[model samples]
Target chain A: MQAWDISFSKLKAGYGSHVVLTDVTAALPAGAVSVILGGSGCGKSTLLRQIIGLSKPLSGEVRVAGRDICTLPPAEFRRVRRRMGVLFQDGALLGALTLAQNVALPLTEHLNLPAEAVRAEAVRILGMVGLSDFADFYPNELSGGMRKRAGLARAIIAQPRILLCDEPTSGLDPITAARMDDLLLSMHRRFPEMTIVSVSHDLASLNRIADYVLVLRDGACVFAGTQDALRASDDPYLVRFLNRDGAGDDAAAGECAAPAVQASLDRWFAS
Target chain B: MPQRNADDISRASPPVKVLRLLGRPALRALNAMGSVTLFMLDGLRHIFTTRRILGRTVRQIYVIGYQSLFVILLIGLFCGMVLGLQGYYTLVRFGSVGMLGSAVSLTMIRELGPVLTAIMLTGRAGSSMTAEIGVMRITDQIDALDVMDINSVAYLVSPRIVAALLSFPMLTAIFDVTGIFGGYLTGVCMLDINEGAYLYRIVSSVTMTDVAGGFLKALVFGLLVTTVCCHQGYKAHLRRDSVGPEAVGSATTSAVVISCVLILAADYVLTSILL
Candidate 1:
C-alpha cells in the first residue's frame, strides 16, 4: 500500500488579534509519522489545527491526499475529516457517553452499519485499546492512560487513513507512555499507509516514533530535520532536551515538568 | 444609631416615593427586554455564519418538534380541563355560563397555549441543548469541530434554533385545540347545553383575529425560547464557570416569563389596533 501525506503551504492562522502560525509551510510523508515539537502556547497545536482544518490559516492552504482542504466547503470539509482521525489533548471522550457510544459516534454519524454491527465494531476497537470489558463504562470511570487509549480507539474506529494526535502520552507514567508509544507504533506498522502526525512535548516518545521532527519555538520552527540529525545536533536545546536529565530548556519550561528547567533555561531565553 | 446627620436624615416626599414605586416595573421590563435583544442578535449571528449546516438543523427540528408533541398535548389537555372546570364554576355564580366558551377559547387560544408550550419545551429540549453544548464547549469538542474544518455554530446552534421555531407552534396549536375540547366537554356534557351551541361558540366566537393572534405570539415566543436557550448554551460553552446549571434554570424561567409577558403585551397592543 502507498503512504498518505499532509502538506501546508504558506499558512497563516490566529485567534482574532493573535497570530499563532505565521506562514507555516511543511510536509508529512505518507506511511510515516512526523512529530511537531514545541513549548506550550508556542503555536504547535495551532499548526496542528491548521493541518486538520480546525483552525483556518489567515493565508495559504492545507492539502491532504492532493486536495486543498482550506478551499473545500464545510460539508466537503467534514467529508475530508472522515479520512483522518484525531485524539484530542485532553482525550475528550465525552464523559457522559459510554466507552462504546463514544467510539461509535463517528460510525453512527457517517456509516451505514446495523446497530449490532456498530456495537460489535465498537467492542472490537475497545478491545484493541484494552478496554473491551469497559464498553459500558463512561470516560470518568477510566484512568488517564485508559482514557488516552480509549481516545485512540475512537480515533481509529472508522479506520481513518491519517491520524492527528495531541499530547498522546502527556499524563501517563513513563511505563504507560512507552506502552502507548508501542501501541501507536504497532498501529502505525499495521496501517503503514496511514500518516500519523502528533504534537507532543514527550521527547522520548518522539524519538521512538517520529521519522521527521520539527522543533517549534516562539511560534516558529527552530529546526526541521530527521530525528537522528536532531539528536546529534550540538544545539544546547536539542542536547539538553534529548538528555532527559538536563536542568532546563525554554521549550520544557511549561507546567508539570521539572522545576530545574524553570530556573536555569528561562534565563537563557531572557538573555 | 441615633446620630442622624443631614445626609442621613434626607427624606423624599410622598409623590417622589410614589414615582420610585412606579419605576420598578419599568426597570424590570427594560432589563428583560435588553437580555432578549442581546440573545436574538447572537442567535442570528450563529445562523448566518453557518448557512450550509441547515439540512442537519432542519432534521433536528423535525425530530425535536414531532417527538415532543405527545408530551405537550398531554400537558395541554390537563391544563384545558382544569381551566374549563374552574371557569365553569366562576361563570355559574353570575349565571354567565354562556360567556364561558368565549372565556376559555379566548384565554387558551390567545395566551396560555403559547406560554405553556414555550415553558414546557424549555424544560424538556432547551435544557438538553444547553447541557450538551456546554459540555462540548468546555471539553474542546467545539474546537475539534473547528479543526475538522466544520463550523461548530452550524453543527450545534442551528438545529436547536430550527427546533424551537418549528416545535413551539405545533405544541401551542395542540394546546389551543385540546383546551377548546376541554371547554366543550364541560359546557355540553356537564352543563347540558346544546352541543352545537358549544362547538359553534368555540369555532365562531374565536375570530380569525384570535387564531392569528395566537400564531403571531407563538412565532415570536418560539424565537425567544430558541434565542434564550441557545445564548445560554453558547455562553455556557465559552465560559466554564459552572454557570450551566444556573443558566439552564434561568433560560427555562426566562423563556416562560418572557414569552408570557410579551404574549400579553402583544395581545393588548394587537387587540387595540385590530379590534
Candidate 2:
C-alpha cells in the first residue's frame, strides 16, 4: 500500500459570501494521523469538506495523492473520491439498509463482486470494528459510539488510501471516546499507508491519536505542527485551550473572542 | 417633520402592510417553484445520462406503484359507486336514467380517474417520498452520498421521478377500469337499470381520445408530484431553522399541498388543450 498526502494551497471556502475559511495552506503528511482542531465555527469541517471535494474551495486548490481535486471534472473527481473514505459525525449510514449492507454499499456500487463476496467483505470489516454481531442491525438500533465505529467500518471497508472523519467522538461517554480513539489508532497501525484526517474538538482524543495538529482560529490556520510542538507552544489561545481555561484573561477580546470562549466552555462541559 | 410623518404614514398604511405581508410568501413561492423546476430538469437530464439506475428505478416502482395499488383501487371503486348513484337519481328525473352509464364511464375516463388517482398518490407516495428524502437530508445521509462520490440527486431522486412517470398512467387506467365496474354494479344490479343499456352506453360513449387525455393528465400529475416532493426533501436542509422531524414534516406537508395545487392547475390547462 502506498501513502497519500492531502495538501491545501491557499484554500478559501464558505457558503455564498460568508467565508468560513480563508487562505488555509497546510498538509497532512502521508500515512500520518492529522487532527484538525478548532473552536466552533472555526472552519475545521469546512477544511475537511474542501479536502474531500464535497464542496470546492471558493479559490485555491486541494491536492490529494498529488492531484488537484478542485480542478477535476465530476467523473474524474469521483475516481479521486473512490480512493478516499469519509466518516460523518452522526455515522450518516443509510437508515433503510442494515449495518452490513451499509458497509457493503461502496463495494457493490464500485466493484462487480458477487453478492456473497460483498457480504463476506462487509462482515470482515464489521469484525474489525467489533460490530460483527450487529451486522444485521440498523443504524438507528446502534448506540452512538457503536454507530461511529460502524461508520468507521464503512469508511475503511473499501481500503481507501485516505480516510476523513468528522467529529468521530463528539457525542460519547469518556470510555466510548477512549475506545473510539483506540480504534482509530489501531486502524492506523493496521493500514499504515492510509492517511487519516480527523476533525474534532476532543483534546484527549487528539493527544492520544494525533501525530500532527492543525488549529484554526477565526477561519485561519493559527497553528500547524507536531503534537509535541503544539504542547510546547506558548500561544495564548493554544495554552488557554490546552489548559481548559474558560476565562479570556490571556485570550483575544471582541466578537471572535466570545465564540472562542463559548467553544472552549462547551468543550470543557462536553469532556 | 412633514416628510418624516408622511414616510411613517406610508409605511403603516393598510395597503402597504398587506403588500408587504403578501410579498414574502409570494417571493418564497416563486423561489420554491424555481428550485423545483431546476431539480426536475436535473432529474430528467440524469434519466438520459445514467443507465445503471434501472434496478433502483424498478425498486421504486414497486414501492410507488405496487404498494399503492390497493388504495387506488378502493378510491376508484367508491368514486364510481357515488357517481353511479348520483347520476341515476339526476337522470331519472328527466327520464334519461339510461345516460347514467355514459356519464359514469366518461367521468371515470376523462376527469375523475386521473385527477382522483393523482390526489391519492400525492397523499400517499408523494408525501412518503418527501419525508424519506427529508429524513436523509436531516440525517446528513445525502451529504454522506456526496462524499461517497455518488450524485445524490441522480441516485436518490431520478428513480422516484421515473417510477412515478411510468406508474401514474398504469394506476390511472386501473382506477378507471375499477370505477366503471363499480358504476355498473350500482346502476345495473342495485338500481335495476337495464344492464344492456348500461354496458352499451359505456362502450359507445368512451373514446380513445378520452382515455389518452386521462393518461396524459396522469403523466403530468405524476411528474408534478414527484418533482415537488423530491425537491422539497432535497431543499429541506437548506432552510435555516428546520431540523430533525420538523424538517421532514414540513417537507412532506409542503410537497402534498404544492403538488396537489399544481396538479389541479395543470389539469385545467391540460384539459383545455386536450378537450
Cα DockQ of the candidate 2 complex = 0.52
TM-score of decoy 1: 0.68
Model 2 lDDT on a 0 to 1 scale: 0.90
The TM-score each candidate achieves on chain A is: 0.86, 0.90
Q: lDDT winner among the candidates? A: 2
Encode model 2's per-residue lDDT on A1-271: one tens digit a residue: 6899988888889997689998888888999999999899999988988888767689988998889997888789888888888999999999989999999988777677889999999999999989999999999999999999999999998889999999999989999999999999999999999999999999999999999999999988889999999999999999988988879554554435477898999999999
- Candidate 2, backbone clash total: 0
Q: Which stretches of candidate 2 lie over 4 Å from their true place?
A: A248-271, B1-34, B48-52, B240-244
Name the 10 consecutive residues with the lowest summed lDDT in model 1 chain A: A248-257
**Model 1, B137: alpha-carbon shift in Å?**
2.6
**What does the lDDT read for residue A29 in candidate 2?**
94
